[model samples]
Target: MIPLTEEQQMLQAMVRRMAREKLKPRAAEIDNTGEFPWDIVELFRENGLFGIHFPEEYGGSGGGVVDLCLAVEEVAQGCSDAAVILAGQALGSKLILLSGSEEQKRKYLPRIASGEFIPAFALTEPGAGSDNVSMQSRAVRDGDYYVINGRKIFITHADVADIFTLFAKTDPEKKARGISAFIINKGTPGLGIGKIEKKMAHKGNHACEVILEDVRVPRENLVGAEGEGFMEAMKILTTSRPVTAARAVGLAQVALDEAVAYAKTRVQFGQPIAKFQGIQFMLADMAIKVEAARQLVYNAAFLADRDYKSKEAQRASSMAKCFATDTAMQVTCDAVQVFGGYGYMREYPVERLMREAKVTQIVEGTNQVQRVVIARALLED
Candidate 1:
């Protein structure tokens, strides 16, 4: 079992209450409209939810990973849409804080932590997913500025981002190591956002392609040492995935909760479905997996918060992310089965829950890459 600090518990309880009061009722509408829940995002900002895990000097609550995990889980339990918005802000901000200079942090951190601004990570391209070294986007040096040319696809919250934490290749000869991280405002010259794409789950979270053509950013905009972009990206992903795993656990819990409630109420063969051995077994399995995934996620989060430098953290994170999201998919699919035809209807929340589970496996790095990570860890050991 994982233990939370008193502060973490308090934050968790507060966010849990907020989730039930604000997010649960609106989930269906958000899913139906496929509209980004900018209002809920605004609500989070107003309540200081976005910056809770940042340093106090940066207008944050002086919180930590435990606080962030609890917050995200609570939000996801109410609505994955809101949880993702929280994750995008917190995780994207973390990149800047870890690597950005004093001025960059001062410029972005205060507003980011205060929800006065939103940030995004732009890395994946139409030609790159797990094999990101294959990306052809280039950043050429020109008169104390970098002229960036690239198109990043599947960027989360691209439509509403304020500052983009992006990656472009600085030296192709170094392969992935030659990549560099940059911060560019949304309205920079030659920067453009594509139309938002329709998605299966996480519908309320808008994603679009970001294009950069001859965009110029000051050399000071670089994050960390040049040619360290891929390394920093890996570090950020490692630290962030465990929180995402927490969200997946919450997704599984909601699925299990809905399935249990339905089984206890729906009658079949002159008795409640809960009485059937089949329904009983499915619920038990879901509960078991949910517990395991939650434990892994929390443990990983604990390890990461202890200044664990980050490769092992990445391993544990991928393990948790892969296991928890796969569990969510299975449990939510079973939930749909438990609800029977009613589950298939648009009115049932479980249908949306089911759709949401699919994306968890795909994003935050795919399960296929998770397997590769696991394999590499063993070989290295």
Candidate 2:
């Protein structure tokens, strides 16, 4: 078990209680109705979950990535959808924290930290998924302003976000090197919302298309310099992967808990199914996987908070994300198996868990992409 500081332990206890008492009861309704949980958002805001990882100077609690991961993991135990809402805040504001000008940070980070404004990261496009360099979005410099034109698909919180950390190519010929990141406000001219995707999981956290047609943005809103957006993105993603891994760990842990509870009471052939060696072995394996993944995730978060730019931190983040998410998929699937036919039904929670676990492997970066990153990091001098 990873040791936690007194403050960390307190934070964990508080968030765990909130998740069990508040979020879990509403999780099913949010999933079934596909409604954004504004009440939950308010709860997070009121409890300071939104600002847990930001600096105190920016209206936050001055915690680190580890704190953020702990909150995400605990919340995910009750509702993965609500956990996304918490993590999404960090994901959207990270670029500004990392690369925004002092003024930009002062203007935006406070609102984000206070949970008064929502921010969305706009990068994925119709043609750009894994190979984001192939993105067709373009921004042209126009005398103190840049006119951005593009469509970003699968953007989380796009419908309600007030600020966007958007990426586009300033020099299409330069490909990846040409990409630039900008801060675009929601009401900018020609900024529009397209289709809201009906997803298989994370129903309460909406991902939609952001349509930018000649959206004019001030030059001061540029994050970092032109051609540095992709590099900035890669850096922030490395820092954020550990949090994503934590989400997977939470989901896997909860699935195991549900399975174990069901197994002890489930009778078969004159004995509890948990008494059967088959079920016993499965439960043991699930527990082992959850513990292993949790350790890996915590280690990565520790490394991130220490020195995110280090190669060791980068590699560990990828490893944690890849391993924990795969563990989630496997553990959740086994949990469903433990329930047998009942697990397959919507009436049971394992089915929902299984669905939630699949996306963790795909998001942040696919498991295949993580392997590539790990291999490249190893090959580097």
Candidate 3:
């Protein structure tokens, strides 16, 4: 348990109240209808939830990564999908803050902080996922602009995002070094939104393919140096991983809470199931794992707030993301077991949580990638 500042604590309390009073009541409807949570987004904006981590000069609250994670965890407790709306905003804006020039930041970061802009990150393509080196997207320098041509898949918030932080290959023969990042507005010429994927979990969370057919972007929109996109992405992931871990922890805690609450009232053999040692043991294990994961996530976020580019921070983020999300999958499954048959039913929140837990392992660079990162860091040291 890391001690939060008074301001952070107050922010957490406000988010928790919002989650319980607002998001929890709508979680089921959002899942069932598969509709974007625009109302929730409006709520967050009204409450000054966007861009909380950027500098105050940029219209942000002068907070840090830890502040972002604290808000995410509380929001996730009530609606896991809704939490993504907040975390995803950070994911979309991270590159700009880390690698964008002063002119770029001054132009965009303030809009982000003011909730006047909704951003999406476009990186993954049909041919490139974990192996970003295999990217096929091309960006040819034209007169005063770069013409980009490629298709980006699994782009979160793409359909509705006001702007995109996109990546393309500026010098194909250079492979990874060839990659370049850009900031392209949504309505840019030759930019098109493709099929919207109906995900297994996080149902209403919007993600789709973004097609760039000779999209022309101003040279000024290039983020950082032309050949530094890959490194910039790595830096973004270093901080973003812990945010995902915090989401995993929050979801796991909700599962544990639901399981414990159900166990106490569920009657079996003329007694409450919580009275049985088997159920008690499961509850205890779930509680332990969730707490442990939470601590790791908090520690990772703290390290990120202190230093975003250090090797230590990268390693911690990878470890925390890997362990916490894995814990989420295990704890959510056990939560279902605690509910017995009812757990499998849609009427119970544990079943939904179980499904949600599975995706955390797959997203944010996958647990497998995290282990590779952790191993390489360990071996290098």
Alpha carbon lDDT at 228, candidate 1: 94
In angstroms, how far off is 199's CA in candidate 3?
Answer: 1.0
How many backbone overlaps does candidate 1 show? Answer: 0
Global lDDT scores for all candidate models: 0.88, 0.93, 0.91
What's the true lDDT of residue 313 in model 3?
Answer: 91
What lDDT is obtained when candidate 2 is compared to the true structure?
0.93
Q: Which portions of model 1 miss their true places by more than 4 Å?
A: none
Q: Which portions of model 2 show Cα errors greater than 4 Å?
A: none
Q: Write the per-residue lDDT of candidate 2 for residues 1-381, one digit (tens) a residue.
A: 568999999999999999999999988899899999999999998999999998999999999899999999999999999999988999999999988889999999999998999999999999999999999999999999999999999999999899999999999999988999999998999999999998999998899999999999999999999999988898888779999999999999999999999999988899889999999999999999999999999999999888888898999999999999999999999999999999999999999999999999988889999999999988885
Q: Estimate each model's TM-score.
A: 0.98, 0.99, 0.99
Output the worst ten-in-a-row residue range by lDDT, candidate 1: 305-314
TM-score of 2: 0.99
For 1-381, candidate 3 gives per-residue lDDT tens digits of 789899999999999999999999988888899898999888988998996899988889999888998999889999998988999899999999989999999999998877778899899989888888788889999999999999999999998899999999999888888899999998999999999998888888888999999999999999989978877898878889888899999999999999999998999899999999989999999999999999999998988888878988989999999999999999999999999999999998998988888988987788999999999989998
